[model samples]
Target: MQGFFHGYAMNGIDAKNRVSVPSGYREVIEARSHARIIVLAPHEREPCLIGYDQAYSARLYEKLDRRFGDDFGPERDDAARRQFGATEQLGYDDNGRIVLSPMIKELGELDRLAFFIAAGDTFEIWNPNVLLEVKGASDPRLARIVRAQIEAKGGKA
Candidate 1:
């Protein structure tokens, strides 16, 4: 249930905004008690959709609940609940496709293509071109990090 898929190819998204769960990562997702997932709007700086397996989402909700308590003085707590409560449960359809809501699709600016990237404890959906631009801009730093990691592992990168 623990593995990572990095730098995968940008792939097509269906008209309904369905994307296939990566074949390699499917096993990990299936290991969750509920195949359902929580999809959240990307942060303003990032153009991506975060997909958290059910268990992870529950853990997140619990943390937020504890930290914020139930003080609804200025509806701050209400707002937080609304934001996180908007998460949709996603599952593979008849053809093994995962359906994305319109809000999520729009949030990530997803159209015909989406880049599915593995993240720790979840997966991310990104607009292909935008992700490419971001990745391209950070390639040098990323390469350096990879090189350092390889060196740490005692290998030629």
Candidate 2:
């Protein structure tokens, strides 16, 4: 709870494009903020979506501020356009699900099923098949890394 996201879950996206947040993840978000909201943005280099809790989003903003400063320079402008401009704030419904926008689904190549992969400060929403391919289904090293990360976060291995 005090560290990063540390598990994976496969969820179904309904026709309305809504998917339930993993229970553990929902608990983490609820613990951090009163608003049941998640911030999602297209991964900078990957064909997936990156998600962050409100607390982590503030941290991201702080980092961006430090890097860009208050200047109207090109770096600041580009960063703003890429990061802030692309971010989406999604509120959980009564069912603890978030509606994925068409743009988000398209960018991430999401179909009916999505695989949520937990990273340290954030998590990723990926198309199931794409995730398997990208992570290499036969690679034991990836599993080891994920186990290590979960353990480091004080989660069950």
Top-scoring candidate (lDDT): 2
Per-residue alpha-carbon lDDT of candidate 1 for residues 1-157, written as tens digits (9 for 90 to 100): 3444444434567776777766655555556534634345564357677765666666777776776787656566675665576567777754557777787788778877655667777677776556656664677664454445435544444
Any idea what lDDT model 1 has? 0.62
TM-score for predicted model 1 compared with the true structure? 0.71
Q: Could you tell me every candidate's TM-score relative to the true structure?
A: 0.71, 0.83
Candidate 2, residue 45: Cα displacement in angstroms equals 1.8
Roughly what TM-score does model 2 have, to 2 decimal places? Answer: 0.83
- For each candidate in the order shown, give its overall lDDT on alpha carbons: 0.62, 0.79
Candidate 1 Cα misplacement greater than 4 A, ranges:
1-9, 36-40, 70-72, 75-79, 140-157
lDDT of 2 at 56: 80
Task: Give the per-residue lDDT digits (tens) of candidate 2, residues 124-157.
Answer: 9887556556774576666565555445544444
